[model samples]
Target: MEIAENTALVVVDVQKGFEEAGFWGPRNNPGADDNIASLIDEWQSTGRPVVFVRHDSSKPQSPLRPGYVGNDFKDYVEQRRGKGAGRELLITKTVNSAFLGTPDLAAWLGAQGIAQVVLAGIQTNMCVETTARMGGNLGFDVLVAYDATYTFDLEGPFGWRRTADELARASAVSLHGGGFARVLTTREIVDAAG
Candidate 1:
């Protein structure tokens, strides 16, 4: 798929909290950050738009709560943040969907004339997936960089447990087959976007 000129790469929930071993166990896509960083580099070089989604949990006990060390972005993300103002847009969200945040991602994308989105982030079944669904429904062309997002293993409502790889596959199938978004590796995305 060809990435349009009016596309933005949305980085979601890639904060330091996800790095806490106890908080997120048995994750897949270990190289997701490297892939994400490559995309960020390409975007920065090409002057493509980029948006970051930060999850600030409302629960006081959560390590991801604001002002906590875990709430800070990882160095890869922080370096981008350090690039200074107007370089990228930051949207803070408490929920699973980035669109439901304080700044209203959907509205901001529309205002910026973003027609297509390339997504890379944490927790495939949660925030990233929800954002893709909402973006698709909102009429934006959405593509997920599979190699640039990771997720932890999960226990299902039926008491069945899934490995991280299983969960990632399920999410990919759901997002692509459900018509929410296309799934591609980071290289494929960069080449397509190019």
Candidate 2:
């Protein structure tokens, strides 16, 4: 698929808090960070719009809560943001969807005349998936870079544990099958961008 020049890359919740493996349990897609970095590089080099979404958890004990070290963006992401300052947009949110964040993602995209969005980031089944669904519903062409997002294992209500890989795969299936977004690998997105 050809990626339009106006497509915005929306990266969600790629914070240091996710490094706490014990807190979030084991995660899948160890190469997610590298893939995300590659996407960021491609977008920046191509002068495409880039939006970074940060999750400032409202829960008191959450690692991503305000004032915590974990609330900071990961080192590499921070560096890229600093280097691309003024050209990139940062959306601070306490929720799952970036579109629901501060400054209004949909409005900003609309103002820029952007009708397509590419999503990447942490918690594949949560923030990334939610943003993709909302973007699609809002009449935007949403593309999810599945390999650039990762999720942790979780225990269900019935005490059944689901692996991180399983959760990530399920999210991709849901997003693509439900018509919320097109799910593609980071490589596919990057190649198409070129």
Candidate 3:
């Protein structure tokens, strides 16, 4: 899909916390971070708006809790944001949906007149999915980078175990079928951005 001039790249929850040992077990989309970083680079180079979302967990034991090393961004993201200055927007959340948290992401986007949003980051079934839903509901054109986000295998009710790949596909279907967003690959988003 061709991106509008008033588009923002939303990078969600790509923190060191998610990288904690076995915190997210057996995730798929191995090169998701590389794809996300590439998107950030492209956004920076093209002078498009870029928003970084971080999950600051309320659970004390969670690695994403404030003051923990895991709460900080991965080195690559940190470096990129450090140099971005006013071009980068950082939104922190303590909940599942970025739009539902303390920050008013939708309002910020509305203020910026961002009609289209490109999403990339971690936990395809969680933060990424929730944010996409909210963005869609708020009437923004939400494009998700399927390969640029990853999630761990999950143990569901009734003793059902879902692999990371299965969860990823589920996320895609939920958003696509629900008309919340259009799921695309990292390369597709990059090529379209070009």
Instruction: Identify the candidate with maximal TM-score.
Output: 2
Candidate lDDT scores, in order, read: 0.87, 0.92, 0.88
2 against 3, candidate with superior lDDT: 2
Q: Is candidate 1 or candidate 3 better by lDDT?
A: 3
Residue pair clashes in candidate 3:
none
In model 1, the Cα lDDT at residue 190 comes to 92
Those runs of model 1 whose alpha carbons end farther than 4 Å from true positions after fitting are 82-87
lDDT of 2 by residue, 12-123 (tens): 9999999998789899999999999999999988888899999999999898998999999999999898454225789999999998899799999999999999999999
Residue range 1-194, candidate 1, lDDT tens digits: 78876678899988998888787788998899999899887776667788888999999977789999999888888887635323478899999998899788888888888889999998888899999999999998999999899999888798999998998899999999999999989999899777
Give per-residue lDDT, candidate 3, residue 27: 83
Backbone clash tally (model 2): 0
Q: Model 3 lDDT vs. the true structure?
A: 0.88
Model 3, TM vs. native: 0.96
| Candidate 1: Cα lDDT at 141 | 90
For all predicted structures, in order, the TM-scores are 0.95, 0.97, 0.96
